[model samples]
Structure formats: C-alpha cells, structure tokens
Target: MRLNHKYFSNLNNIANSSPQGIMKVSILESITNGFHLCCRSFEPVASAHILKELDELKTKTKKTIIEDVEKVKRLESEDRNALNRAVGIWKAGRDAPHKDAKFATDASI
Candidate 1:
C-alpha cells in the first residue's frame, strides 16, 4: 500500500528524489541494464518472432470471444422460453390425483 500511495500520489513521477528513492532507482537501472546486455544478442530475432506470435494470438482470442458472445446471446431467449415452459409444466402437475401434493403459487418465470 505504501508503494501504491507513493506511486498514485504523483502519477508515478516522484516529486522528490530522496536518497532512498535514488538508491532504489540506481539498483533497478543496474538490473535492467544487466538484463538488456544479456539479451542484446537475441533481442532482434526474438522480439520479432515473439511480437508476431503475440499479435496472432491476440487476434484469435478476440475472434473467439466475439463468437462466444453471439452464441450466448442466441441461447438467452431460448433459455427464457424453456424456463417458462418448465414452470407451466410444474403448474400442470397440480392437476394430478394427489391431494397432499402442492406447487408454490408464486412461481413466475
């Protein structure tokens, strides 16, 4: 929470660079630079392959979501109609020859 307060208080741009903040930033920068150095050789090829695959995956995911949404919408009215039919059937069951059996009066679809 302290991290959140510090971050959101200034929209992630710290107003004051205290000694602690400076040290933290320096450590982070050093780590980032080290990683960058390690990946420098493969950065170009790996980035191109990874980004293309990521874009393809994103497009497929979006298309699948759209299709699922349409399917659910089509089923929604059918589900409502089925529910109404079930309630009507249950109401009809009241006519059976069982004096002790009772269906709730407040059942509404």
Candidate 2:
C-alpha cells in the first residue's frame, strides 16, 4: 500500500506534543503492531476484532464531541440572555436618572 508520508508525519508531530498525545500514540502503536502480527500469522479474526474496537472508539469520541458542543451552545445562550438583561437594566437606569438611584447602583454592581 502507498502511504501518505506527510499525513503520517503530521500525525506523529501531534502525537508527540503532549502527555495525552504520548499515551494515545503508544496505544495506537500497540494496536498497529498487533494488527500486523495477526495479519502475518493469518489470524483474520484478531485483525477484525481490532478494527471493531477502533470503530467503537470512533463512535464514542464522536458522541462525546456532540455532547460537548451542545453544552457549549447552552452556555452561550445563557450568557447572551444575561448580557441582554444587563443591557436592559442599564437602559432603564439611564432613562430614569432621578426616579431611582438604587436601579443605577444595582446595574453598576
């Protein structure tokens, strides 16, 4: 098989960048070595099993990413709502400067 040298070199750089990267790279190398050994030994079942695990890992990672995105969206919405409320309060205080000093103080606070 023709390998993508640039792609693999980039992956290697990423894998060597941090502690988590090191651990992930180590696991990946172990799995790759096992797959090669199984193939050489004519153990198709073992190779298939490794492929299945990799697929499951991909699925789990995707699920986690989706969940994280949802959480970020929710937090952003909450922050926008809060900012709108603050702006509304500030506007109200600015509109009625003499009627209520408390409103201006609360808004500033």
Candidate 3:
C-alpha cells in the first residue's frame, strides 16, 4: 500500500502542475488563454488584429444571447433556423480568422 500511495502522490503532483490538467475543458476558457499568449507571441499589429477578431467574436456571442433575445424570438421558423445556421458559421470562422496569422519569432523586439 505504501508504493501505491507514493504513485498516486506523484500522479497528483503532475496533474496539479500542468495547465491542461488544472484548467477547465472549455472553448471560451481556451480562447481567453490564447488571447494572453497571442499578446506575448505576436507583434503589435498582428496581436491587435488577432485580439480584435477575438474580442468581436466574444462581443457578438454575448450580444446575440443577451441583447438579441427579442429579435430572435420574433423571427419566423425559417428565419430562426437560418440564424442558428449563421451562429454555426460564426463559430467556424473563429479558427479561420487566425489560421493565416503568423507569429513573430522576436515579438518583443
């Protein structure tokens, strides 16, 4: 039982030390973390563009759910379905926005 206890202790230490293990598995959470990394890893203009896209994405998501409730409810079935499709498109565009973005080798320079 002593060996098993030591093994579990080592496993716990490894899990606690890693960000992946400590952080919740979530897209928004990951995106926020990515934003921080992007700021440090990219140049000013590149970072600004990437941050702008991410901020717009977050703002659009918030406004769509909170500010557009009435607008969504008033839509016809077909239109509502189209809106849902549009939301999916928006989600798909999230990665596309930064796919072509290049990171600076010496961002701090």
Residue-by-residue lDDT tens digits, candidate 3, 10-99: 655665667854432232233445554334334665678899999999999998888677666667667979999999999989857675
What does the lDDT come to for candidate 2?
0.73
Residue 38 C-alpha lDDT in model 2: 30
Better of 2 and 3 by TM-score: 2
Residues 1-109 of candidate 1 have per-residue lDDT tens digits of: 1234544445324423554565345434444455442445456656899999999999999999999999999899899999999999888887667775456873542
Q: Candidate 2 versus the native: TM-score?
A: 0.51
Stretches off by above 4 angstroms in model 2 are 1-42, 97-109
Per-model C-alpha lDDT, please?
Answer: 0.66, 0.73, 0.63
Ranking by TM-score: 2, 1, 3
Candidate 3 residue pairs that clash: none
- Highest lDDT: which candidate? 2
Q: Report the lDDT of model 2 for residue 70.
A: 100
Show the lowest summed lDDT stretch of 10 residues, model 2: 34-43
Question: Tens digit of lDDT per residue, candidate 2, span 1-109?
Answer: 3336686667678888867785556544645455442334445656788999999999999999999999999999999999999999999978875754466458565
TM per candidate:
0.38, 0.51, 0.24
Lowest lDDT block of 10, candidate 1: 7-16
